[model samples]
Target: MPSGYLDLAELEQRADYVKTFEGVHIPGLLQTEDQIRAIFAASVPKLSEGELEVRVRFRLRRQEILGGVPYEAVIHEAALRIRAADSKVARGQVLQILERSEHPQVTVRVVPFAVDGFAGIGDPLTYAGGPVPQLDTVLMDTPHGGAFLDAEAQLARYREVFSKVEEAALEVIESRQFIERVVRSA
Candidate 1:
């Protein structure tokens, strides 16, 4: 439980009721080990080799929830195509997306770049389901750190944003095709 974000831990504990909205990068629960490693290496260049390995392992372990629970993600196309690592790494990442899209418990949708006035233009956010709908929280990513939103007003705003983003995104099947097309071109 190394994740600094409380919402992440809550999501892991109650993954069956989670719905995620990812506008920047692939959601953590869907990332492969290599992709996680590459991302950490780039983001924290000073991390020692051992530390990098530990972090990558932790990330992969966190992703294990995908095997047992239900979740949904709406990823922006810009996040998918951005080469955070080398070409081969990018290809592997795309392939991971293709594989995960097949899972019955997961819904992977892509918001194409052509969608005008997308709601996710600012940053990526995640909404975690609670025992009661009113208790759910919205997690927002920031350059300095992550922020959790549980206030009714903030949750309402983020929910609206996520709804609009999902509307602009392709359906799961079409998203898989779009991802495959991008992977081939990559």
Candidate 2:
């Protein structure tokens, strides 16, 4: 869980743009209600039914940012094929990416499995903008929890990581087509 001052909510309020990369799971801000519920249902320890509902509600609420923020998500093809729930939910997840990719504020790109020399194997990351370059922050997910990095050296490394990962991703139109194929075969 995130703290109050530096949580995703507060960070989003301060940033104008956010770029993310997801490997094994869908990024939170881009997830739909049904997909989020499915993710929560698969919690490792197994969240209680009530806990699952609460997390799902919180996740769905965060997705509202997609309508206004200039957000870009580069997702791995493996994440798309990994089923979080039944076929219905997996199909919905594929279509969700396709539908949201069409939004003016949201850009969804894919890092196909065939890409060579891919570098983003660590974890999901959100690189957020700040009023000045010096104030930028990088948020990386971990099994323990979320880790925030702001030192100049750390920021620079993540910046390079994001750039290389983004470059390996398909272009907007190609990404949409790739996801559309997944949807059709789902």
Candidate 3:
């Protein structure tokens, strides 16, 4: 994994539960191959073909953690509508998310544009719960790279943020229907 992803991957591996709040992009755990490739292809410095493939592989591998632990995602509607790749890739991404949402341990919720109260925090964040509460960690992306927050106060703040985001999201069934509507439009 790259430096930006090392700590996140390690935390995912050690976590027994995970919750993510994404306001702009699809959670990495739910993104498809094309989506991941498109994201890397649009990087600031521009990754070479080999570098892109390596990073894609690392992310795909990290997704394997989803099957081993409970996972919940509160995704903003913008992520579902964005064409990070082409229309085909965007449609496929939504389809994959819908399929994954069927998993017993996987929960997907969406916060639609119609939601009046939630404007979203700043960036997307992943809250990984370790075996013990004190071991919990929060990961958020920064312009520099991924930032890890494990301090008690930081964890507490992120927990509240996650709770608010989750509260604003639609129920699981509604989210699946919302995604289906997006796919139909695609």
On lDDT, the leading prediction is 3
* Candidate 3 residue-wise lDDT, 134-154, digit = tens: 889899877788889999999
Q: Write the per-residue lDDT of candidate 1 for residues 81-168, one digit (tens) a residue.
A: 8877778878888898889878888889998988887742558777876678778877788887788788889978888887887788
What ordering of candidates by lDDT runs from best to worst?
Answer: 3, 2, 1
Using alpha carbons, what is the TM-score of model 2? 0.93
Highest TM-score model number: 3
Off by over 4 Å in 1: 1-7
Q: Give lDDT: candidate 3, residue 155.
A: 94
List ranges where model 2 is wrong by over 4 Å. 1-6
Off by over 4 Å in 3: none
Residue-pair clashes per candidate: 0, 0, 0
TM-scores of the candidates are 0.90, 0.93, 0.96
Residue 47 displacement in candidate 2 (angstroms)? 2.0
For candidate 2, lDDT tens digit of each residue in 11-103?
876788889999988788877788888777878889998878777777677777787778999999998888888788889888888888889
Candidate 3 worst ten-residue window by lDDT:
1-10
